[model samples]
Target: MTTTVVIVGAGPTGLTLACGLARQGVAVRVLERAAAHATGSRGKTLNPRSLEILADLGLADGLAAVGRTHLPFRKYFDSAFVNETEPFAGARPSATTPYPASRWLQQPQLEQLLRERLADLGVTVELGAELVDVRQDAHGAEAVLADGRRIPAAYVVACDGGRSTVRKLLGIPFVGDGDPEPMMVCGDVEVEGLEPDAWHQWFGPQGAFMLCPFEGSTRWQLQASPETDAEGRTVPPSLESFQRLAARHTGREDLRLSDATWLSTWRINVRMAERYREGRVLLAGDCAHVHPTAGGLGMNTGIQDAWNLAWKLGYVVRGLAAPALLDTYQEERLPIAAWTLDVTSSGMAAVVKGIETPGIGVEAGGVGDFTGLSLGYGWSSLAGGGATDALKPGDRAPDAPCPGPDGAPGRLFEQFAGDHFTLLAFGPGARPALAGLPDHVRPVALDDPDGEARRAYGITGEALVLVRPDNHLALVAPATAPEQVRSYLEYLERLGA
Candidate 1:
């Protein structure tokens, strides 16, 4: 079958890109090797930035209904109670930042939400379709299934994960170091004698063990330092081993753990692909980069990667921008991946140090900046045209309460809710630039009677702000140069020509 984009993998990254592309009316085919959707509570935290991306996709209400916004860290040292602290304590939603705290929602739950949304967009995930090889040329790419079927597309994205088959097929090197000792044994199991209100952690001299209760459920995610046998090989994780660890670490045999659902061992492996693109075949999510599960960044970073690439891919697939626009995907996300590796590695080191030292508490070491709001593309060539003291090109477009065209209550995010660029005209002086906009650009004239929008955007005078489809600032031109807006769009069209 021929399609515009063939995505390999039905995980969060691939599903997110599929939803974004399908929302923009791009034909997409999602292939997953597994026969059915996998069941695991992997990567439970959805940072604020990821929540904002989902909010733009119109899933904010759905997420809020199911996700827990506040789950304090309840720490314990060797079966004794310590203290509780919430990382995002006192964080409230503001006009500029809507989703302020990280959410506790399991990966499977999120994938289900995305799948439902994708189904609404007339796309479905094709299961049991394992990609054996990929062939790409100047015009298009083809995904070869193990069962002797070929799927052709204009481009292919490898969201297949850390041990990506597509990356290996393309001969891309995954450069990083794997820890000599395995890190932790993790799984989802039914638990009793634990309240589902906080993340329960137990740290001892032998190793640390944690059982974090899932929101609105009786199951808790289990993570414990690996136990090795006589040969010094790490013992594989199982229900029996999990029960033993719970008894040994928490010093309570009454804490019953039963019905082990999913099990796996994790190691500290920090690595990223040397590049994100190989001709028409691009990489995203865990396929492009894999880091330590510190700060709960693994899934959030992948979600952001798909969001950053989706708009560019939509523009290129729809013939609105050049392939050079696709180049910026690597130019922008690669650095963020690198920074993630560095910080997560440090976070992991801190945890390991805490584990080795007595009486030292390790409190989610990589929590800083995990919100991902401060990350941007200011260094990219796509960022240009003026800046304010409060905002600049490549910064995230802040949301504000503004009146719609009918002079009714509205928000900047409502204007940005679909697959379109948003051109914000700060005042009547900047309204002229909103005229003659491209079909994909949505124009919003701000009537800030109380100066709320101006206060949020730091716009003392009239200005025109061109927001990318991903809600990042593309151009911050003066109101006098209305032509700059049109010229910028034309420049984008002519890029890579």
Candidate 2:
């Protein structure tokens, strides 16, 4: 069957892209290798910007209901609490964004929630259907499944993991090494003697060890970097090894290992694909870049990629833009990925050097502590290159409370809950300009129309803001100027929409 977009690997990034596309009424197919939805908890936290994305998709309430609101900061040295940043002061949401702070949650829960959203959007996922083969042409790409079913799509997006089958099939060199000097181990096990409410790390003689309590009691994630022996090989991991290390590090001799969920080794590799697109097949997520897990940036960066690409694909499929618009995806996101890799690589180096510095320097309640919302792309076509611009193309578009035209208090994002472009008009005078927009565009006026959005656009008084389907600010105008709007629409036309 032919579809608008065929997404391989129904992980968080692929699933998020599917949902975003489906919400835009674009036909999409998600092929997952797993027999069913994921059950294992992998990722640890969801950044505030991701939460805002979830909120726009209308899944925020469910996630917020189940996820734990992190409230405290606890750092340990030899299993003893040293100094902690005031948890309440760590991160805060912007007055413009609905979600100001980050939340802690399991990856399984997030994937399950995203899958439910896919169902809500009427997009079905083909489980246990792995993409064994792929062939791309000038027009489209055809992906062959393990079961011998061939699916054709206008475009193929590779959201598979680091070892992506599509990526390998395309003969794209991964172009990176494992850690030059590996020094980290990660395993899920049921262990005693740890607090579940906080992330606990213990710096010891040979290397540091960390115990992060899982959702259930007696279950925890034990990660440690053991000293290499004379031959330069660390000891193989086992329950006895973990128990002995725990006792030795924490002075908690009574600790015992009960169940081993997963035992795995980890390394830091900061690498980017030489190119994000190969003909009609494109790559996102870990398939595009792999970085150290210093700030939990891997999955989050991929999700943002999904978000950035989804709407552009939809626009192209709907005959609203030219295909060249797809090129912007790589141009805009690759730099962000490169920057993230560098920052995380530095952070990992600090950790390996046994330097006890903060991952996020701000207090627990401050906005500066999180990595999600603060990332910006200055060189992209999506952002307005205005001085002191509040809403740039590569920056997040903050939401605020506004009254609908019906004179009731409503949220600016609530209007975006559906599949369509939103034309946000600030001040009373911009309403006529919004009304004159094409039928494909949805219009919204601020109840207490202030120039904050105008200020974001480097304008004053009445201004018009064009928001793409994926919530990106396409263009901003000082007033009801149709020329600027038409210019952007023409640009979108050149992109294939």
TM-score of each: 0.98, 0.90
TM-score of 2: 0.90
Candidate 1, clashing residue pairs? none
Error of 1 at 27 (Å): 0.8
lDDT of 1 at 204: 70
| Prediction-by-prediction clash tally | 0, 24
* Top of the candidates by lDDT: 1
Worst 10 residues of 2 by lDDT: 360-369
lDDT of 1 by residue, 273-366 (tens): 9999999999999998988887888999999999999999999989898889999999999999999999988887888777645444445476
**Per-candidate local distance difference test:** 0.88, 0.73
